[model samples]
Target: MRIHKRDKARRRMLALLLAGVLAVTGASVLTVAAFAGQRQPPAQPAATRMGTVACGDVGSLLDQVPAAAQPAVDRDLADLDVQVADAYRSLMAPGAGGGEQRVMDALVAKRTTTLRNLKASAGPDAGLPGDLTGLASCGIRRDLVVDASARDYAPDAQAGSSGSSGPSGPAALSKGSGNRGSGLGRGFVDIRTVSPNVAKPARTGSATGTFTSQCGRNENRHLNPDNVIVAPGVSNGAHHMHDYVGNLITDAFSANNRLARAGTTCSNGDQSAYYWPVLRLLNGVTEKDAKAPGGGQDSNVGRILQPADVQITYNSAAGNKVQPMTRFLRIITGDAKALTNGPANAHASWSCTGFENRQLADKYPICPNGSRVVRTLKFPDCWDGKNIDSANHRTHTAFSQANGSCPKNFRAIPQLVERVAYDVPTGVRFAVDSFPEQLHNPVTDHGDFINVMNRNLLDQMVSCINEGRRCG
Candidate 1:
């Protein structure tokens, strides 16, 4: 989602993968390789230099809560996130709290009371995670990996200047509204320096087909801060701006009927809602939402970079044929709270155009000339086949195993891979918008989708995949 490199050496990774046909889903099938033409950069030191407030992930614990209880539970959970973020800021304020521990202690005390209330909301049969009281405590993250090749912008240039892409040219590097303890820091790596770490799986599966959705980039500027899948009806649910490519009227308030009747950007009349956090260049320019809740006010400052290309492809699971995903199916890929929750659910894949083989989960990529930044988010392909959504927004679907087999009680479904590319000017730092406490780390990058495809169309997609034909 973020970086800049000062070295002007032009080393094209001819051995790296640019584009080819493959069953793109998860780490199992992905491969990273470096071309033998260039000298390798020094090994990167893998650790975060900055620290941020870390707390128990309350939302991830709930598997299934009553619809009636979800409102209160959701509100309480969202409040918990707010409280932790607030404490993080308090820790950063001039002459802040009793240091990090005291601030964490205070946050834990507050969270204890909230956890009690949340338990009350869920009741006995809600199936929430255990040890709510134990989850109240909070801490700090100091072990996140930092990009060794990270380069800072020219200090004298204004935050909003649209400078050149060369070594000495100044790209937009803003102060994030002077918001301390935020923005990108040592989060970018030179793509040419990374060696191949990905390997093709031992064996390919039975299904060998793909269905692509030709949804154009957000040409109409369909942007918002709502997460209809996870926090429906909650304004500013995401706490950051999102770019939409499918459904035109997907917002915090968009109901099922409204979404069905809304216009779409898809050429084939598919009404699926595809959205993800906006990638931002730190060029010091004021955006339309600079002072809004999800913008500068939320510490997501900078000019939002429109993706140069976005390819939404669905590949059949390797295990077996995929059944059609029901309308209204909701799937979320990646952890928006990964900075605090760790990498268990994180799906970040950042790299440059020609260096797609060298995917970096925690670092932004500095591309060579004519190259651009890229974000690859591959969704889980195994469906439980019962619920369209789950309490935690994840249990309804799951990722296929390394051999591309569905797990127990889970059936193969079309796995969605959202590959978005951005033309970030060379030598400029950029970042994915995130919760202020997350420090806009590239690891927090995520994607959201709602399947509103018509039944006939979905059936057609399934047929295309099962037939081993690449169709759109």
Candidate 2:
């Protein structure tokens, strides 16, 4: 009878685990092929600045933006798209239309309107917000937050829908040999070269806990619209969507004060929220693109792709005892700028299942016949010994060294490593859904966290980590 009761408990937990996957499926993207009649406008010479603020000044402007101002940030992108679409239509319409200069003037006016909207929404509390001139030029620069429907018309817009035919087979390979890595090289170096000596966790405690959620499950709640590290504020939750499998509510509004009171999927009652950018197939179309004015892109387009496995591990970094994860503590695992600026402070990377030999930097790997693609994100495990957050949201903690040891002046905390894999065919090219300037660079891939776990539940995780036991 005792054995029977124990088996019942295990079964119950399993049921709860499966029940946690949120329902997320089908995405859209806009393909230029869908454009009927009107030819694409001729390229105009670059403007001095993109929006009201020059691109060079965009970084500083982002500093003053606030998390509460995401709604306004989203509006700015929406307004820009509306203007671009209208202008393009007018230029291409079968009638007397504005010449290139007219288009340029229209772009300038639209940019000014967007800048004014940002300042008004930021309000006096944030003080004069940063200039938004770059939004027009860098329409797809990875950080701008935009609505799903509007994304189809966004810059570097690839054409395709999720259910439609994606980009045809692997990118045409260079002449000579037929094998992996034979295509025109785009700055891809094997990742194993840099991570060969890295340390794996010491052990899985009996109580090491885990929570699983289906990828592409909840588009509405998971995607992070802007750069988490750069634009901490202006948390516009648009542009890209994500899959979540923990605390129910996660958004610009997420806060420690009320998170504990929210609902959760963790059977143990964990309220922590885990999320990252949604992965899309390289067909040139996505769920978001499908909803555009024209039927979504049907040719190879970008759309959110589901992961074969979504594993969330809460384990010890000390390789000894598990440390308690502080309440409301925030952690950012990968460098968001790696794609555009190179891997200066980046910790995220992509590798193949069997070709573990090559851990790549910014570009996605061209896998062999049967190997699969994997995205590995390792979070910092060293805490400042105090403080749940820092002004930058990153300085409060540090990453464990290659040996898995925290630096001095910091304490070890449970480290989280998220591994997402996809069944991308042998050679079909794939790229992260980022800004047009990035060319789908993989370096932009990243993840974010806000510890809303109940205090009691956090203690339980701590016990499991410290006890050197894995729990689920």
Candidate 3:
């Protein structure tokens, strides 16, 4: 009976040992499953996922993954991280959806395709941990900000003028007005009446009879009941006014007459008249002969001129060079206050120094003989006949004469004034005193006339270039 009891005890001990071993094995299996599940969490929120994915933390996460699944898991996590980063960057990037956006999107798409192919080949078991995905999210945000900033601070693009001042600011004298006394004053001599004879006869007689023979010897005498001649009678040549001054006088007279008829005083005199025609010309009224309707001439005349067609000519003994002028135009079709400043008043002075430096480098690389030439002319220097210097230099000179100064700089060139003459059959001739204080030399304290002219020329050239016209 004792032997039987020992056998039973031994069997009982064996059973208890087996139960302990089974319990340990079950716990081990549960632990492994839990670790495996946690390592490969489902896609989480971008912010939270990235926070958990520390760099170089993949090894610890992979410890729970089976040996065979390890490679697949790693590849999947890497791809997911890359895709998440790419997605975030795309949405946050500046100008992301505009024209530039497409370029970046293409790059992201190519990378995504590559990653997707890698994941497909690696299989589903090869997935990345949540931490890796989170890191990718962080990287995406960083890249997006960097790309956006780069695009935002890029260089200023050359955009055509957006309602900025441009050539065609003011109206110019019309071509038709060349002969007619249209804008102001007693209209110029009738071309029909004055063309046949250069001079008007003192007394009314047969067309061929001499004035002295037809009338009494007295300088001022009545030849017949109907005819009287004044000594030094008006001649077509004398009556004709072609120069700018003459045209100005005629315009002033016309303006004054209109004002008088309207019961208003045209008290502004020659200055007012001179500018009036210019303003009219700029308004695209090419026919100087066409009168403003209803005698509203003076009121219409005072409006600011905007030049559409500008002609700039330089004439000297050497030859003549002319450039089509363009005014910096500001359209005032919508509002009358737009007419306040004329082209002359609104001109901007380009820096002479900058122009000189650029031009010299471009054109005068070598002297006429191909020898290297050194640039001696400096900024603020004016032509003083024999030398170029800032001091003791003359400013304004006639187009025919250089005031003894060499043409080393653009400021020294003379601008000629052309006006329509009423006395002459042909329309235009030169004018006296068309040269204003603005055109005179600095010694005379006449303001910077040369600078003004140069600026005007440069502005015209720039406008032409902008308009896609050949400046040459």
Candidate 4:
């Protein structure tokens, strides 16, 4: 009977994890007693009212916890609410905008304090830390501040609407044969300006290759079930959905051995997987499920309308002597702190397909008669020459220099660039889906990759980079 009860508790915890609530594993052992006296609650009723609820007004958020554990979790969450609210008030002050750096620092400190207190408050048997920490990382809090500060915040509606002319890129050319030769707008973020256009480096013993676009064979490769973005052990914890292209099959459950056997869309047979959150066009038909798919989990704005094709590109760093990346290697580019991380931390660029010249900050590009919309993602090239993964998901790799050279003790690898083009027709505007707390800021857009190639396939990619041969 005791064993059966234990099994029941384990199943319950797993269900919660899948539902995007309980994120930690090894939690069932702690939940049995807490849940033994409590009756399982009924499924949540469909929401009758739909509107953005401030983090403080999330009354239903705590209803999912086991009755026995609710008091402790609620107490800590309430305390955290107060701290976050106070910090938001301070940062939103009219003149306080200039002190963003200071605001972020203060919020992080406060988050640490809240985490510590929550940990202390959660009794050993409560199993609350992972869930609490997952939903309230300093990064998450920063997004909240950004959203709270914005006036008339509406991500879903914004995502589906059409865009206005921005400062960067070409004067908006539509897609057609005649649109050729038009360049992107000046001062709008363009890799053609920053990255070298050389086919190969002049340095001795160096080579270069450019693999053209490969149509997306799969969008499931990097749908990380054990994403570090949320609590550890939480399947599909990222809350946001991602579109992956390259490795044929990958998910939170994928393993090196499995990926080694899997085929790739890259002509070189490189099975390295890359992905980022999918952008959604909010065309009235989609519901505004802020924390979509599952409430109190993703908290993102908008619904996803799949794109026709996702383009994948693999190539060497523009001007660097890049070494082959080791199998299973992983790293994070862009600012983990996101929008709060500042200008130097930004690595994302956006422009219209033909009008790639004009760039706008935080707004989607409006294309002209013959153009499409495009998002360009550039990965870091510098590797630590060791350690496949890091605790923070970064630190194992660094960015290359402006001249396309690796930093000391780091080797350059093929720079992964992805161009996702949308087929939205004229008069329709779309925005990248973001956390509701981000207030539709483009600065928070980022991508993630994991090298899952086996030894033989990985070796082949190395040869392509080193020998200056373009494959596929």
Whole-structure CA lDDT of model 3: 0.21
Kindly list the per-residue Cα lDDT of model 3 for residues 1-472, writing each as its tens digit: 0000113443354333222212222111111111112321122222321111001112111112343533344444444333333443343334343322233234344444544554454344433333222212111111111112112110111111111224432111100112234321111111222212112213221111100001111111111100001001112111111111111222212332342233111121111111111222112233332333211211111122232222222222122222222211101001101111112112111001112121111011111121221212111112223221111011211122233233333333222222111111122211111001011100110011111112444455334433334332
Q: Which residues of candidate 1, in runs, are more than 4 Å off?
A: 1-50, 97-106, 127-131, 142-185, 201-206, 317-319
lDDT of 1 by residue, 314-415 (tens): 877563688999888889998887655555567757777887777776666677879988898889899888788777787778888877778677888888
Clashes of each: 7, 60, 48, 24
Model 2 global lDDT (CA atoms, 0 to 1): 0.47
Give the Å shift of residue 193 in candidate 2: 11
Model 1 quality (TM-score): 0.79
- Give stretches of model 4 more than 4 Å off: 1-114, 117-206, 212-232, 253-258, 261-269, 287-291, 294-303, 357-361
TM-score to native of every candidate shown: 0.79, 0.57, 0.17, 0.57
Residue 2, model 2: Cα distance from true site in angstroms: 51
RMSD of every candidate to native, in Å, equals 14.4, 15.0, 39.9, 15.0
Q: Which of 1 and 3 is the better model by lDDT? A: 1
lDDT of 4 at 354: 53
Q: Write the per-residue lDDT of candidate 4 for residues 1-472, one digit (tens) a residue.
A: 0000113443454333323322212311111111113322221111211111122112212212333443444455545544544454454445554444354355545655665665554444333335443334332121122223223233222221112122332222111222123321111232232222113334444567555545463544333323332122244444446666667676654666776788777655667666676665544445344433321133333455455556665666654455667877765554322332223334665666655554433335546666666776777777777766432244456777757677677787877777667765554434554443333445556677777655765566567766777766
Give me the runs in candidate 2 sitting further than 4 Å from their true place: 1-238, 255-258, 284-288, 291-301, 318-322, 385-387, 401-409
Best by TM-score: 1
Please name the candidate that would achieve the greatest lDDT relative to the true structure: 1
